[model samples]
Target chain A: QQQVKQSPQSLIVQKGGISIINCAYENTAFDYFPWYQQFPGKGPALLIAIRPDVSEKKEGRFTISFNKSAKQFSLHIMDSQPGDSATYFCAASSIKAAGNKLTFGGGTRVLVKP
Target chain B: DVKVTQSSRYLVKRTGEKVFLECVQDMDHENMFWYRQDPGLGLRLIYFSYDVKMKEKGDIPEGYSVSREKKERFSLILESASTNQTSMYLCASIPGPNTEAFFGQGTRLTVV
Candidate 1:
């Protein structure tokens, strides 16, 4: 069973628009949430991360909105650009449990049209 | 910067043959992981090691084994290669909990 679930297997947006991807987890023990971005032929890289203690965290054009009660978190890309097109994955893990291994969502492919 | 390096970018092996995928990390991380990536399936952990000679099974450990003889090197062994095992394999390393994990370029293995 997938401990974490993500939606919109794929997404398409225009330049200067906003692209959002959402993920939900069933494990309440999870405290650390991170988003990874992967371009074709490359490994996933850390985009941004947040803890349940915070409702939201933003880094430049990327933002992570977390809802502890809802057990969901979403990634929003502002001014979506073609350079931002890639596969995005949301992951959750507990620092004190299970070696802190990340449980990743199915992943969402994002495309930005120029 | 942390760097994780896989032995190969691509490999082709015959069914029933033994295959070894090697990964090395330069950051001297205490945690290392092996994961397989498949379309729509995301990344599935095959095995992880917290320290030398200490390993744990991830969500998917069947048909796979691991060895961490040194803190910097983690090896994944396929006792008997199968077509079903063909996929993109990624190696990651993290200093510890709540730390960022760095991934390698990935090795695409194909079992014929």
Candidate 2:
């Protein structure tokens, strides 16, 4: 079973516009949600993350809006630029003694047109 | 910054050959992971090691094996290479189970 599900396998946004990606998880045990950004031929890097206690968390131009009751979360990138074109992944994890095994969504490829 | 380095950027091997992929991390992390990324499949974990000499199978560990003799190094071994195994392999390390993971560039392997 896919514990996490992401929408819009591909996204196209105009430069300077708002780009949003959404993810939903079925596991209530998950307490941590993280977004990862990946460029071509490069490894994924941590973008932004949020915990269940917070409804929203913002860092610079990146923001994560989370809804615990809905079991949904979204990533918002303000002022989207061509440089922001890449693949994004949403992941969820819970603290476990065996180690925090992450459940990841398929991925969304975003394209920002200049 | 934590750095994870894979031994090869690109590799080509014939079918049935035994292929080895090596990864090293500089952060002295206790946990290391191996994942394979494909066009639409994203990243699928092959195996992970939480400590030296300890390994756990991930989602797709059928033909893969792992070894971690040292804290900073983890190795993924392909028992027998096949064309379907061609994909970009990534290595990652995290301080522990609850922290952010740092990833290596990747190793693009093509089994002919």
Q: Residue-wise lDDT of candidate 2 within B22-48, one digit each (tens)?
A: 999999898899999876576788898
* DockQ versus reference, model 1: 0.81
**Candidate number of the best DockQ:** 1
Per-residue lDDT tens digits of candidate 1, residues A45-92?
A: 999999998999999999999999999999999999999999999998
Alpha-carbon runs more than 4 Å astray in model 1: none
TM-score of 1: 0.99
For all candidates in order, the CA lDDT equals: 0.94, 0.90
User: iRMS of each prediction in angstroms?
Assistant: 0.7, 1.3
Error (Å) of candidate 1 at residue B43 is: 0.6
